[model samples]
Target chain A: MENNKIKIEFLSYSENEYIARGFVSVFASTFNPSVSWLSDVKTAVSEGVTNCIVHAYPNEIGKIILELEVNNNYLHINIYDFGVGIDNVNKAIEPFYTSKPNEERSGMGFTIMQSFMDDVKIESALNKGTSIFMCKKLLNSVEE
Target chain B: MDIKYTVSNNNLTVFVYGELDECSASQAKNILDRIINDNLNSQKVIFNLSGISFMDSTGIGLLIGRYKKLIKHNVPSYIAGATPATEKVIKLCGLYNIMPKY
Candidate 1:
């Protein structure tokens, strides 16, 4: 795989959370990140993927598309879910803000993703879907 | 993930064997809840994460949920045996700060 650009589609089920976590962890391996750096990446990816499974479809299984790319020592990840879109992006990313409080959600999904990744971007349209784009800089310096 | 626990001298230490995430959160929560309910004399809880190959925010939620329940029972709790990876997740979420480690 040149440049290590990859894409995958999977069912939006909680069980697939492991697949999502493992996929990104393996993709981030090319950067030779530290254990801590890898944990950050994995956690960020989990939050993004979990959000889609738990909230986007709301119990109904749907499709989640994941796109990943490696740029030097940097990794860029995009998780897309074509289900119920966020009504307010601003409020959604706030800490301690969750739509499903009954589920005992800590409302830290986006916060965790943004904290672990170097950059996080969200785009969503009501009744359409949401896309989470996150990037993380690996600890190991790029080898020339 | 399989969850097993050992109780000694009214103190409980729960060991998590495998990934802890949304899929396993329900089972973990149920198991933990039962332990907490049954161990009325338990003084503390120590959650071991060393065997957990993977963890996420849901893991944190599970920890926090259980911790809160213990608080009501006056049974303090802490986390232990977290590997470098699991420890990173716990520390990053500020959960380690909330619950002391042994």
Candidate 2:
């Protein structure tokens, strides 16, 4: 397999979360992954993008960049947001930890991403922005 | 997202269709709440997620929020017809602790 990459930039709106999921799922389809694997990828992408729309730009809309790369059997996803960065990355990732509990946020976005992806990383600077990098290993790739 | 409900024998069942994500959750919350409130006399409530094609933590939040609302009225809630994928998320988030799957 050869390396492939795609990049998308869009507003950090709740609706774009679905687009992000669709884009990554379609990209991962090139590997002929199983239905379960594709669903996992889509769910992970949804969480990453929702994080940006809900938490990143809580006050106003901002830009979000989604980058997808396929290398061998691995699917790499990078979701970047230029909004109010997280004040505590560690606390933010904790299970059931939410900055906006009143909004009915489950605070499981990062947990879902980490659960579905093989690797997860977060980089953020207060008043700057936050970027989430996630990678998933495609197992049992159906042969053509 | 589209939400339809049926009331029978003092029970309220909400059927949700479409992706349950951040974008749809707020809408779902409002619709579900209204239905549940209108059917407050019901003894129980159920969420039919068979029509849902995708769900994430936001979906979990939506369900949990509704569960909290129902519990306040002494109306218990159960989840029904969730796909395996959605169930995985529900279980991972411990939503079953509050609303059991039927």
Candidate 3:
């Protein structure tokens, strides 16, 4: 398949998380992914956006940019937030490691993203922002 | 998100409608907590996710949060009606360790 791309910008509000998931799922549907594959993509997108809302802009609203690109059968997602950045990306990705334990945070956001997607990468700096890039290989919809 | 609670005998079942992502987690948390508090005397708490269309890690936090609240009241929590998609997430997060499936 030819490369297709789309970008979305929205406020880092909890409500927008659902909208982000919906946008990505719809964009991915063009690939005719299976039901489980589509669900995995949606879940990964939700985790990425939720991180921006809950951790990136914890105190105030900020802008979140979601970009989707399809190359061949691979789906690429980039989620960005210009809010308080993570102090440690390695520790943040650790399972059960949460910065906001009191808020019932399971600290599984990054873990979930990594699990659902084949590739996950993070770049962030304190007081600046964070960007998470993920990719997943969608199963071919056309039968051999 | 909409939440409905049903009490039968000593068990309290909470039905969740809508996606259980970050958008609805906070509201669901408050509502579920209130329901659990109001029924502290109940022996168990069950979360019915048949109506849940989608869920992410936020759902895990919501369930774990409720599990903590119920345990404080000496009540246990169980999961019911989780779809395969939601169940995959639940198992990935090891939520069953705290709140087993019923």
Instruction: Summarize candidate 3's per-residue lDDT along A1-144 as a digit string, tens digits.
Output: 578999999998788887888898789877778888889989998998988988899989999999999987688999999999999999999999999877888889899999999999999999999999999986872343
Top-down lDDT ranking? 3, 2, 1
Q: Comparing to the true complex, what docking class would candidate 1 get?
A: medium
In model 2, where do residues sit more than 4 Å from their true spots? A141-144
lDDT of 1 by residue, A1-144 (tens): 336789899998888988888888787776567777878888888889888988899968999999999876678899999999999999999987889877767788898898888999999988689999898765755333
Candidate structures ordered by TM-score, highest first: 2, 3, 1
Per residue, candidate 3 scores C-alpha lDDT tens digits across B1-102 of: 799989999899999988888878778888887888899999898999999999999889888888888898799999999999999899999999989999
Q: Compute DockQ for each candidate against the true complex.
A: 0.65, 0.88, 0.88
Q: Write the per-residue lDDT of candidate 1 for residues B9-37, one digit (tens) a residue.
A: 87899899998888889998998788778
Candidate 2 RMSD to the real structure = 1.7
Clashes of 1: 0
Candidate 1: clashing pairs of residues: none
Summing lDDT over every window of 10 consecutive residues in candidate 3 chain B, give the lowest-scoring window. Answer: B21-30
DockQ of candidate 2 relative to the true structure: 0.88
